[model samples]
Target: MNLALTVLNITAPVFLLAAVGFAWVKLGFEYRVEFVTRMAMTLSVPCLIFVALMRIEAEPEALAALSLAALSAYGIVMIACFALVKVMRLDVQTFLAPLIFGNTGNLGLPLALFAFGEVGLGYAVVVFAVMAMLSFTIGIWIVAGRGSLKRVIQEPLVAATLLGGVFLWQGWQTPEFLTNTIDLIGQMAIPLMLITLGVAVARLETKAMALAGFLSLIKVVICVGAAWLAATFFGLEPVAAAVLIVQVATPVAVTSYLLAEKYGADAQPVAGLVVASTLLSVIALPLILAFVI
Candidate 1:
């Protein structure tokens, strides 16, 4: 109940503001939605990442869980999702790359920053980094079904992850005063992203929304189930499992919809998936958190 209320309190204003803007545009503020997405992407989201990465502390033990699971567990799920995509001969739009790759940075990051705080998030970043890189290269290949390996290689998301890894490896924590500033900016990331998301959903048609909803269920169920079994086998502690589950269980990355739209890969369904998963995550989060943490 506390968690539910917290999500409501945080999400309501963000969503309502976006809905109003969307309605205003429909009422005919067309630029308002664009403004939100741009601001969030360029300014807010990056700040959120910088702040979270600088402060988010990964313990040796928690990091161990990540290292051990990389090849065995995470690898297995990635391979399985690919196999399903191949065996079922699904549409390019329904490929596992985009649906399964997830949105750990924008949506997942803020949620972790709030729900678990600094220490708990460290482990989550591990799973996050893997999918973060793959989302552009492998995920785009799955979704686009065209050769863009070079473009994918140069994706900004990929660059950010790589830079972040270097900084992490270099142990370059931010100065105290800068940390304060970054957190304040980072706090804005979600509201702006959510507002953008709500507007994006408002743009989608009914059929698209329905398709997205169906895919959203598949993504979450597959991810959470895989993460749980892996955590169990790895003998992950409650906290370790909790971190990983959140990494997998987060809603489709808001950017997934953007990518779909850009790549002509059924954008509306992806939008629907993002919106539905986010709404349902209210219920889903606590259930997963309890089992793990």
Candidate 2:
């Protein structure tokens, strides 16, 4: 009961405020949403990631648990999604983005912070990093149906991951002044992300929104079941497994719409999925946490 109450206390206001922002845009102030999203994705988000990575104290046991959870949650999901496309007889591009493009970084990262603090997030982020690589390079390739090897490897986030890995591996300490500056800037990620969602929601067409809602429902069931089962089957510790599940349980990534739009890979449904998933994720996350933790 205490744990449940703590979860509610932390999430309730955040949920309400996000709803208010979404409603405000739906009623009016659509432009503000776009501004927030742009600000968050381009600037604050990267800083937040960098800081999170730097702060994670890599212990051998927890690190191993995190890796196991990440691999189990993400690896299983990706494989299931691949098989799903063939089974459903769906177009690869249209269906693939909905299945795999989870908001693991933006929304998932914050939730991890809330649940596991930095320790939990460290595991979640590593899982997200793996998913990002697969989603961006392989995901984009599959969606586009034909992209150059260079194009696949050259995405901004992919490059960031590669560079960031080197930095982490080098064990070069980030100066306090730099981390402080990044934290100041990175603090903007949450608000910026919220406003962005609101604006994006306002722009969604009615039919597309309906489809996205459908996908969001599907995502909730799939993510929760898959993550929990994977964690259990893999024998991960409860808390570590919960982090992986939380990251997977998040709705579609905010970046999914942008990727779809940029490549012309059925942006309308993708955009709708982002909105629906974001909303649905609140319910989905708590349920999974209850079960897993």
Candidate 3:
């Protein structure tokens, strides 16, 4: 009973905030998602990452281990997803990236913060940073047939991760006033991201939901299994392992739909993925949290 309540307590606010956005859109309110996403990714999320990484006191060895584990997990997932796509004869351009990259940023971060507090956030950010870097690079390549290394370098979130890592490594702290300001900016990230996720889902149009649902279930199983194996293989600490699993098991990101639309790779199927996977997460994430937490 206590465990169930704890899981609910941790997840309620995150989904409730998203529900607010979903309801707002249903009421015919205007939400410029592109603007919100740009601001969050460019400013607020960067601030959040920089602050979290800068302030985290976890052992450097632990952080390094988690980083490598995350990388290896994603690599393994990529290989597994590739084989699945081949067997199903799905489009490499449309199906592969969405399957390989989950919604580690908007959903994963807040869930981690609520489920495991600041320590979880610390580990979650590392995974988010890794996903962001890869999504911008290889994920993009899969969709567009060419990777944009320049775009990856120009991304504010990438810059923040690199800079925050340096600060953490050197044991440096920003001036008190500056830190406070950055902290304030960082505080906007979670709520904004959650709401934006809801808004994105509410706006998307999907077809082939049956196929999407089947794939989504497979994705959850594969992602969670791969993450667990990677965590155990790498000997990750308990918190790190739990955070890694949650991050990897998140739903297909709404960004996948946008990329498919932009690259002419069949946006409808991608939209189906985004919608189906997200709806599945409503049931899937909480159940995963029940075990992981």
What TM-score goes with each of the models? 0.75, 0.82, 0.98
- Poorest lDDT segment (10 consecutive residues) of candidate 2: 155-164
Clashes of each: 1, 2, 0
lDDT of each: 0.63, 0.68, 0.93
The residue-by-residue lDDT of candidate 2 on 1-293, one tens digit each, is 98788777655655665666667776755355456665665677667666666676664456556666666666667777778767867667866866775777656666677777877766676777767766756677766766455754654445545555556656655788987998899888766665455556556653466766776787677777788887777677766678777777778875676677777787767766776777776777776666755
Tens digits of per-residue lDDT, candidate 3, 179-285, equal: 99999999999999999999998988899999999999999999999999999999999899999999999999999999999988999999999999988998999
Output the number of the lDDT-best candidate.
3
- Which clashing pairs does model 3 show? none
Q: Name the candidate, 2 or 3, with the larger lDDT value.
A: 3
